[model samples]
Target: MPATSYLRRLCACLALGLLVGCRPEPAKPLDQQLYVWQRQWRPAHEQALAESRADFSTLRVLALQAQPQAGWSRALVDLSRLKADGRPVIAVVRLDGQLPALDLDVARTQIGQMLADWQAAGLNPSGLEIDHDSASARLAGYTDFLLKLREQLPPGLKLSITALPAWLDSPQLPALLRAVDSSVLQVHAVSNPRLGLFDPVQARKWAERWSHVTERPFYLALPAYGMALLPDTGGVPLVESETPLNRGGERRELLADPQQLADLGHQLRDKPPAHLAGLIWFRLPLPGDRRAWSLTTLAAVARGDALSGRWLVELSSQDGLYDISLVNVGNLDQALPPRVELSAEQCDGVDGLSGYTLQALPQHLVFNRQSSARVAAGGRRALGWARCIRIDQGAWHVYP
Candidate 1:
């Protein structure tokens, strides 16, 4: 075949899902969305949502969840505030993946009541998203449930599902995708905890392959949070997110790197899959939500802004006692620096808390980070305190 003929052939097959070798066509910029995964809405949410207004355009709020032993657990969301926000809202219903079987009737009834209450309260949800992590072999039954739910829903209201990449190999996957208006392909924390969160290479592969299986538009559910894995005698570590575990021991912390995710977003924009729509960040961060990204960092990543963290050591004194803190003045979230040192004379006492250790030397007091914990943009961390006579104010240094 001539070069011109081959070029035409490639263009003709670009949008078709028939060949895995076909390259994706250039796509429009993806829209940004967020998952409000908190079960309880508080006054803090009002501020978090307001600050996120400029970046995210849609909200997927947790409406209800199915608990195996306790039946249904509904979220206490502020519907009036949601309506006031004026963004497209998608109500989410979560069914625990661990459940042996789903009771269709109970699910339908609970869903109906929730939707009715929302509608009756004058806040209309733009869509419904079902978040269930069913085993690959059970997708047939799951399909039936979704199909029935779709038929019973009000007309023109969208229905979507939280899809896992593990379903890619299952033959029944196509039918499941067909039952919904869209899907949120969750790419973060889907694998073993040891592998870390948010793999850009694997994520791209999943999105590209998923596009071949579904004709409907789908969003990628990326992580904007962290998790703590506590050692368990049963082999699998106890995974903690948003909620705390009373059992406290040495644990491994995994955080989704903002720079890495931002780079992936850029790649997807440059070469996006067919029918790929947007990104839905998992669980928006609020004040004191230590496991999540700050809104400043999240917004910067969403907009593909430059990332750089600026840390300054400022010491406040009262008599001979001095308080030390590191303040981040830049837009990026950064890992704790290796060491911070301050020149002092005749130090009587010194201390460091959190992830830092304090050392009192002959001429300087050193604060060393003991872990890879990070500080957020525009955030502050206390490096503990010190009591000394005649400390040099101009000799503090922070080492990266």
Candidate 2:
């Protein structure tokens, strides 16, 4: 080959290499944060907020509720008591869809009044977020309402909306996005029992699709809370309220698994979309809220830690019978074994509870068919009592 031809080939190869090297890498995963939705106002929540403030960039507070007849009902959140520690706060106002027709003027007036009231009380919020799950047919009305509300907001105050997944492909979504500073896509909700809440696969697809269509940055909201459902005679699961019911029914709980959240974190870290701002938890964790994730579990999940199950077996004596309680002391949910056998020299027979089936063996009590014994993290369940010939000190072994 001639010297000129060889030089040209070398130069072309160098240029191609340079172009490949200069190409930008995929974006990193967004930071994860919390959303405070508890309105009862407890000191423990305040402490948790103070301690975990470093993990979050902003705190979202529930400030108002839009009603049909009354217009807007102010939620009893004591803004003065919530210490932000210099972090910005976004006041979240929820809309109850009880009105047959939405009045844009009424919404604007109520929002303006609430903002002014906050200003008067010496609370300066950095943003205002509207939480409304609008149907596809009502997207136009919802967009118009948001536009009017945005006009009345104080200058320099950012506006945001909590968006439903079903409305992502609607043509009116562009109009609504244009009217707000940012939109939060809530990926966790309990509309069906079979699918459970927080389908990670579906959520990832939605995030990818939204990123391609929108230029505005958005946050992906994940769940840290669980739901308790009770099946009626018709076999439909009904959500249980905080109040106790007079009727007897079987209860089942759906918890947000830490492993699932950690897996999602890993996926996002590898190839997070460009338009994703970060992740926002549905609500902050409280120690007393059994349905919500614990602070330790949340931190571990955010750090992309793989969780393992740990069980603690405790034996208690009541009415001349030995009761065994299986407690999940770890930060992950565990599936109860199909059959659990306890071997003890002094045990004769065992009695089954509502959650498990019991069988008597030669020298052990076999607990079988435990289909409903799923225990949440930090939850405890009694494994029924064992009937013995007499009470005496003896060694016990558990077999899976």
Candidate 3:
């Protein structure tokens, strides 16, 4: 063929390839709309806020720094309105005393009154969420306070608490989880450097461990907003402002973005561990140009169509050295098929893993250790839901 003819054919083939690669497009404007959520109310995000209808049934707000009677009063009104519209509310009560921390008796009395006041104002919360940065050292006192608060809490009310991520691995965690009705493990990995980097792989491990240990519904509090890096005069992660609130106060730069948040959320959806209610985007009134991005994501989630299904596969050195458990959200259980064979490539060249055999449980796709060895060393694997799994097998397919 002539050179000109050959070049023309190549161009034609390239265009055809591009067309074929594109998947069927999702809904246009409706699917593309995003919600903006922030810690403080601003006229800027008003449009986004009005448009957002993010599902709050599984959402809980913990207003920690809210103080002053008037501020508290306004917050109560907002909570009341939200509850009237049918949304769950959780007010994080901070202890006023130091050292031994106000006597649990006094603490309980004060918090109870606060709750009563809110209830009287026509804002009936599902329950209270106890939060304290100093809660680590004051675990004993805090635990006592929570236990008492739980007892004093009226019937039909629920109790939950915001736990610092550092405390998740604490020896006291078991007892702490035991005391609360639910736990919102503040796994703010982005904000803390000491724990480690933002490894979604490791996050899967933390989620699995917490779910297994706590055996309670918990909120995955994520930093929808990014952190500003402090100039290191010395060899330390220094900043004019340290905490998220402080960072915002100082007007520092942000590290995470909307695209990043979407990536993180999708990663969690795949094998949503047991009792994994949903995600909480830190505190609201988000500061920055990304406000719309956050709100849009929330609205998508609220619509109950946030694309969810991704897996966390961890491969280790030796078979017995580590565990490769998968939290199954594909609805694969004993009632369905006992065993489904996944090929090596399907297993993604995992040397040890043969296939997956789901348990009777609906929320776990755990991989046995012996079976996991087939997966390649130092490699993790995940399976995305290409299509939705049917709720149940039909009558025409009834077994013998």
Candidate 4:
């Protein structure tokens, strides 16, 4: 027991304590917001907004839009249904991409009237978000338009814009960023429709680059919906979202995976970029929204909760006819099964709908999925009907 041994042990203990003290704490969870893109608010919105309150804290409601020669169209938002409590609300002004020019006079008139209408409804919007997809070459003109619009806005009212990554290459980007109090960098449906709906890797890269350009706080607008591609004679497919075109042809669906978005959010929060404030999920989902995520699934993703999916085959019978449907009884969204099989004593007049084809064999009927389809959490998908004396519900199976 010498003095030298005691000194060595004391020095080792002090070093270990320093190492533990220097370890950084975990990052805080990012804020969550929603884009209420529905032009016509329904009674269902009451329930949706109430359920979303526990997770999301902001609402970017679509207020009005301008067409090429159609002047302006205002959304039929029921102010009473939009009881967002104390959450911040931002009114979004959409400018159609087909417009040949940016008309500040029209914008001033349109936005002023829209704001007055909102005030009449007792909606005190905290900000104005200009949703435009101006070309990269037009950033200079866009910046000028923003500056002019900012002057017309009420004093102390915040101004923001929906930005695209294509503008990242523009030399006048910094000036454009300076014209707004904030920006929402949209990373979905910014490219060719054939490529895909969204790419998390590209989204991350865009956010990192955007952080390097603007000093103002910003948020990322991620997709929580799907789009359908309809075949056209011009070789280019027409993209449909939230609205259905009554054209009669097989359409391919492109959905933004919820799991992918959840993972991206986790990564961004783990190591947030400079001035990156929060996440704004595109197109808040309604109960009957076919191309959007369910409220249960979306809420789980925003809270970074665990995901587990359970799909069950359900059969409803009426007069020797059995209707087959896939029910998602779990809290996780899942891809539709590639194949569905049903055992029956005898079935006739078999058919399939909603992206499936029916194949009838001796004692089993196979519903083969021909395109990509997704089943939302706590949702159902029809797989056609069967005319049989008995449908063996206990023997049905679904194959991925």
Candidate 5:
């Protein structure tokens, strides 16, 4: 090759390298943590806490609540047990609606006293979080309250707040952001589905818009729980229970789809802004909390893994009686057929499920699936039982 030709090729390669370096680098993945908001401390939660400690960098626990009467309702966490593993725990102090309306000095003193009590209990938390859903009208008051609370907090301890999305547009947002060490933008709520809870599209838009305006780092609080909406006498949807409803009024379970969560994770990783801190899950999963996501699903979403649907059917016998159950072991709800038929050669009698209707066929027992009995994700329902006084075979057939 000619020397000039080699030189030209080298120059082109150098130019390409420069262009690549000038282009912006991809955003790093968000380092999100989990929030434990169980009002009643349970022994089982310890395991969940420990597991969370292993997976995430930090855990935020609801430690106290400022009641409407200007008193504190403290959560009883076994600090020794929680801190034994040496993971960081941020104590969250939630202020009820009335606190923002109280006298500034009085509220300040009460908050300070709670911090002192926590220290007295030998829990020197790494951070203290204030959770208040301050009304739109109380933005200034809430801002002032936080500023005062910050001054009372011990030096070297971080102060954080759970912020509503609307606050991102408030005029006082900048001052509030400056007052706190960090903020968690709670992007999920139990509202109507015109816009679903934990909508990734809206979440990404919020993160992009607010991250540029806020001076302090902010984390996104995602939902890991479900809500059951029941209709009232006036045909309005009311929150009936946190758990999935299996009987009575019309119910809708609002759960964040795992795919949407994963997509959001990708968006944050691709172009996360300077003020975008990370993500924090609303509540950790408990063993018997049917409305909450299972630990497996939560972990999968955090890791940005694809979630698949699963169905499980089991039959067990005791004292000449057999019980059938249908379980959803996946992270998405599943629909069942209108009726399921069960048959066995030696089955003597069949009892209908209390919440569903049953029809006897010539060779099988048919159980109808009530509209309300549709199984939710991570939900379990009893299908009915059979009395088998004698059995020539240990086989049963189920048809959907």
Candidate 6:
């Protein structure tokens, strides 16, 4: 081999090595990546503010007020405070344990008083949520009791409930859900302190179950406080050593530092389950409480909304001419490659479908199956077909 030729080949090999090194490393999985860091306190708080201002009409904050205690009353007062602070919506009480099977007269009187107190405090909402662990056979009687109570509720006030994931497998579950205007499924894993943070693996599985069970609108209840299941003499939840803690104990106290909350918001944003109307934190207390969760923590979870600029876009329809209009569903927009294969619900060649196809207007971006059409706004109004999907009948997403 000639000396000059040998040197040239060596340089070419070195250049190829440099190109491979310069290419960015493949992105890390979310759970493996270092959490986003906050450079200054101001931005962290501003992030908190941005979350407060984001549109969460689909979200509902569950404020647990069981029976009548100063804590419950205080929680109700705080509901008005948060509502005034611009929080979109909230659920006044959380019902867990065996309360659902209680006689209606007892439950109704207690609930009515809570509603009366909420109204007195200038926090009037017709929707009341009852949250409980799943007991399928008992749900029938529970639904009947709720229907009776609904008849007596202030007209237009809705009744809602929080369900356990196991209910999804139960044949009676859908009927139970039908009794209310909406339902929230608590998706966190319940574990013993010795076991560690709620198992993300199990949590994901349950999230999928609830998502499939409740095909209609529903919210996802996230864990703000961690629970340690005590040793039970038999198959029941033990409370002798009941202490609600989070993933990292004091170090990972979720609601205390803005960053920790942001981390949670980050986790949620990365892996949002389906039919997720919005996120809910466990409980709320006075602005700051170390042991008990507070409105601040709830606010912190709300703060995660800043990352929610996500929209699921799909090419919904294609006319005989093969022109396609991409449909954007949910609040966030999805970035997809041009002219690729996508799921059918995502974009169909027919109106009211979702997927992507390479084509130009006169195109329509129909938001949902029902709406006639929406005007294409990013200035390429060549007029194929443009439309907005409605989450329901009246709500429409603004398109660019």
Best by TM-score: 1
Query: Positional deviation of 378 in candidate 3, in angstroms?
Result: 41
TM-score of 3: 0.53
TM-score of 6: 0.48
In candidate 4, position 49 carries an lDDT of 87
- What is each predicted model's overall lDDT from 0 to 1? 0.90, 0.75, 0.47, 0.89, 0.73, 0.47
lDDT of 1 by residue, 1-400 (tens): 9999999888878746556657565478899999998888989999899999989999999999987787798999998988889899999999999888988888888998999999988888989999999999999999999998888888999999999999999999999999999999999999998788779899999999999999999999999899989999888888888999999788788889888988998998888898999999988898778899988999898998888888888889999999989888999988789999989999999899778999999999999889777788988899989999967878888896
List candidate 2 segments past 4 Å from native: 1-29, 69-71, 84-86, 190-194, 230-237, 241-252, 313-329, 333-400
**Per-prediction CA RMSD (Å):** 7.1, 6.0, 25.1, 3.9, 4.7, 25.2
In candidate 1, which residue pairs clash? Answer: none
lDDT of 3 at 147: 80
- Tens-digit lDDT track of model 6 for 62-128: 4444432232322323444434645434444545454434556766777787667667877776477
TM-score of each: 0.87, 0.74, 0.53, 0.84, 0.78, 0.48
lDDT value, candidate 5, whole model = 0.73
Q: Is candidate 1 or candidate 3 better by TM-score?
A: 1
Q: Which stretch of 10 consecutive residues in model 2 shows the poorest summed lDDT?
A: 390-399
Clashes, model 3? 27
For model 4, residues 1-400, the per-residue Cα lDDT tens digits are: 8999999999999999999999997786788999999989888888888888989989999999988988689998887667445688999999987789999998899899989888887888899999999999888999999999999999989999999999999999999999999999999999999999999999999999999999999999999899999999899999988988878887888989888998998899889999999999987898768899888888888888877898788989899988888899988888888998888877777899889998888889899999876687888999998788888888988896
Q: Which 10 successive residues of model 3 have the least lDDT summed?
A: 391-400
Point to the candidate with the largest lDDT. Answer: 1
Clashing pairs in 2: none
Global Cα lDDT for candidate 1: 0.90
Model 4: per-residue Cα lDDT at residue 309:
91
TM-score of 1: 0.87
Order of quality (TM-score): 1, 4, 5, 2, 3, 6
Winner by lDDT between candidate 3 and candidate 1: 1
